[model samples]
Target: MINSHQALSDTVISNGYCVGCGACAVPEQSPFKILMDSYGQYRAHMDDSPVFGRTDSSYEELCPFSSSAPNEDDIAKQYYAETCEHHPQAGYYKGVYVGHVAEDEFRTRGSSGGMGTWVLHELLDKKRVDYVIHVRSETADKDLNNIPFKYQVSRTLDEVRLGGKSRYYPIELSQVLKTVRDQPGRYAVVGVPCFIKSVRLLQAQDPILAERIKYCVGLVCGHLKSAHYAESLAWQMGIPPSELEAIDFRIKDPSQPANRYSTYAKGPSGEKVVPTNNLFGADWGAGTFKYKACDFCDDVFAETADVVLGDAWLPEYVQDSDGTNVVITRNSDIQLLIENARNDGRLALDDLSIEKAVQSQDAGLRHRKISIGYRLHCEKEANAWVPTKRTKPSRTLNPRHEMKRQRLRTELRDLSHKSFLVAKKTGDLSVYTTAMTPVYNRYLIQKRSFLRRTYFLVKKTLKAMIGR
Candidate 1:
């Protein structure tokens, strides 16, 4: 009767703030449906004549972007206030470590040190949870065009093992979450920051899900990319988007640094593998094809998750081609599991100070936490509706140049999505490149000391001429 989507449609959806995590669509009677938009990014579509708030969690309360919804800080504090130490950027934490699974092929098979999959498998092997919900490659079609990967329910160790590797493409949670609701069992979900926060909010609303969902696992995200990111990489490899079948985003090459990875793509003609660095939009810092919501998010570490994992992008660990993981544990139960495995010689872990853990994702934290204000400031200056965020909007919050950097990133993100769509329509990959190259180059220049040097040189010349 309340027409739940009225508020969401007006703000989050209208402003392009929706992240398509699918928590709103999980309710059986919900009006929201998750669908891939023309930009190849999934978005929430709300149906007419739908009621808001099934229980205490109303539409605003449930949607992570809503002003009324509990933010990562609020959610993390609710679950982990007394048990964990809090940081401005990393939320709550019980323990932090850098390590890799020593016993199995997890290190080699995973995009990182294998702890992402290893953590899920540990729970499954111990019967701690009946099922695991994580994204997995659907290898049914080696050349998988329709949907190459999805959020699947894995019950056994083998199934869990099948679900490793980082997927950069867009994925939503509604379908898999619905599966968890239909099937009665203890379930653990793995997602990025906002998705896990969505789960925590949903749990507070629905008793069934709250009881069955035993763990909330998180992946430390720089940001979520649209499907076009995968398509762009494939296109660069001569596999047109139309002919794209399957893609492996993280192919570890031992000769290179752990952070340097390759991408493998297969099409009807043949298969191709290329270093990820060779691709134009491969720069994570550029935020190419990234969801707009990511620009405003402050949570770099998945604060709402019980346990979170990410690549140890530190100097000491980056040399190893085998890869390493930076793990943060908020729950003692998960901490014990890792310690037990290390004690059993199945895992090799080292104590990582909070400072060092934050260092691993230094750039991401600065962007999300510090640069967020510029993004918010930009939106407000245009008189647009933005979700209430933990950090308030202010251009002066960061150093002056950072605002310039944030604006350039904003330009790149918007242009990539729009240009890629044109490319998809015209069947010419250059449409995207033509549109993005200069801006990308400009962004790269902003990252270097070249601009600062040029600025100072020009300033000195102008001062001398004026003095004369």
Candidate 2:
């Protein structure tokens, strides 16, 4: 038997299922606070002082990992309603596009395209929202390498533009949402999928959040990484983790394809730039520094958001190092704004079919939607409490890819925790490199094996024969 009193702490925080969305700490007098743990990830900490024999169940309601939290479909249906069409991969949407801002300098600076920044600029310039809540790098005169990024409320177009580019660092909304609650004003917030969902959940409970937050923009996410991800990459660039002052995860390289970007780090020793692929543990698939909660989440396209933006990873846009964005517009007003921009020659956009939109993030969809079931099963086998998910758990996988998928799921689940701990304890990234190399090598072997390729070809042949 389990006590319902400690449910949020026991099931989420203790089990490493907390995604650091900061919902539990939103209430002014809440007992929980968000803090960085030893492993460089944000986690909720409960007050040690005992005040009562009973627990407040409200925290569980806002927690995405709790069974009480509504799944992505339910949230979308409640918000989007009949105005959007739903797909298993891309979720609900009114329109889809592959585009970039017409400005060359802005286009080159963004992680993918300048669409996200452009949207914020429009919201502020048109006075649609009084404030733009987004993540920006932390800068201080003391040390460049140790500055932590944060979510800020930008009040001007220049401030919003200064916050452009993708921030892969961990950020939570509790403090900023409290600001929104105290100082009432129309606001627009941008975040990754889970964080956006958390904001939606908070709005449902508090009328202040509901009234203040006028727009929700979502970024397509493969997974969230801890602070160690930056440290690890910086260490590989000849700057120790402690000496890092600032880091930019996405820098366009003219000689490389759009998919290939470089990371720039500023340290006490000046600055260093390195291609992402050359860095150890740069493989996003291995999930070296990923948050555990990401594995159980299935909302790849941010179903509940007003609009979602992601890298346009299709063949047509891969040749452009400046990059392009794949966007899905769910709100009529935002759709009109984008259409107007295209018509006025301020934005370059082309129609993107929903099928092609799904194809754009095929691997992410497969891992988040399909492989999730297997990961959940693994959790069950270990008797770990798993969050309720829209995607159900199953042992079934395509026979052709079963081995590869299984290997990846196991390695990612284990490595995410292990590598972070090793890096934190020893302060040496080589420990992570030495440990993950063999595991990743094995994953590569399974993926490229002759037998696996033969199995896939045979399966295709059989499917064709059966169709004929």
Candidate 3:
């Protein structure tokens, strides 16, 4: 087996598989430190001091990208057993639904449906958990020195409400989790898929964490963005990186559809809100400021969490300006709470088919499940140490589609490092625009290719004929 530090450094850090979940640095007196790189992405860096002795294998074992950690399927099997229903793309779920919290104020403030925040709120109000570990804007005092947001331990309803919307900004768990380890409390934490998986792995090894962290609430992730994602959006609103103080990724516009939200940024001058579509590099598919590790992930539904929440992107609910959520509940108690809320008129929910759950994240599923295989194959060809994935590698892609996927994968891999580096050197966002415009254009071209269109048409026809 590779030594812990070498394994992590070579396979994950060097190859760009680290998601910066902070598991490695959360342990007591850990040697690794989590830092934001020039690209505005959270990355782990090892200290030069040898005081920690040989790297602990527990770090590798708990790392989401390490081969030593259990795959999503294995984790699901262990957690769900025979009671859960499974879908190839969505993993195990006890129930799937498209709904929204009935509370207008909460729904209006949430990223999509606000169910995630509500769940955390309920967990706290009911005294089920002593504190909630979630992401929130760093206090104004703290914002002067740090980024706008970070993971914090919230002990009251007001503090939890302050963290309502989704934060696409880069955040890691090390500092907050270190606090969790030292403090005494039952906690429910919300995170993206990889972060939740890392928590589970760490829980397996550390009994203290396992006891303190009671519930794992996961967000259905498309991918992660670098700090530049916010900077790019703010720049479009006439706020430069240095002057950007805060950014809200999802601001519900009364006139727009649920999918057409706005990004609001605060700077020294004032705050500006712009429709995401109006901003350059705002296309989620282009991977403008995406972390490279996201390309290697296959969990679109956060398979191992107690419950998963995401935007209801299906046509039926997409037009709802207030917002709607697509939810998958695996924990019986959480499911019952949802049912109780709906029954009491606090939540409006409709039973959703398992197929709909998969469809809600169809684009993400396609990228994570199918395109990932090809990406893996390419990594293998390059002799890279790819993280073990439940999705088997294959070159079985439509020729036109394969070309587009290959280009996107390569562009994204380079864009993460290059865009940030260029922006840092020039002290201008224009450098990023100039570098990414051409790449995004090519991606759009492939997306609209006649061959790609024909391939989809044929596939749809076959599926329809077979009644899929």
The sequence of per-residue lDDT tens digits that candidate 2 reaches over residues 127-162 is: 899999988755522332235888888898877877
Off-target runs (Cα >4 Å) in candidate 3 are: 52-55, 140-147, 450-468
Clash pairs detected, candidate 2: 144-245, 144-246, 145-244, 145-245
Arranged by TM-score with the best first, the candidates are 3, 1, 2
Q: Give the TM-score of candidate 1.
A: 0.93
lDDT to native, each model: 0.88, 0.82, 0.84
**What is candidate 3's lDDT per residue for 1-468, written digit by digit as tens?**
656776677778888888888888877667789998888889999876776455476778888888877888888898887778888788899979898998746787788888989999998988889999998878823442235688999998888887788888899998888888889999999999999998999888889899999899999998998887888788779988888887878888889898899888888999888899999878787777888899899998999899999999999999989899999999887888889889999999899998987898887887888788888887897888888888777766655466565667578557746875787678877787787777777777877784577789899999999995
- Shift in Å, residue 441, candidate 3: 1.1
lDDT for predicted candidate 3 compared with the true structure: 0.84
RMSD of 2: 2.8
Off by over 4 Å in 1: 1-3, 49-57, 140-147, 450-468
lDDT of 1 by residue, 360-448 (tens): 99999988887787788889999999889998998674456777788899999999999999999999989999999999888888888
Candidate 1 or 3, higher lDDT?
A: 1
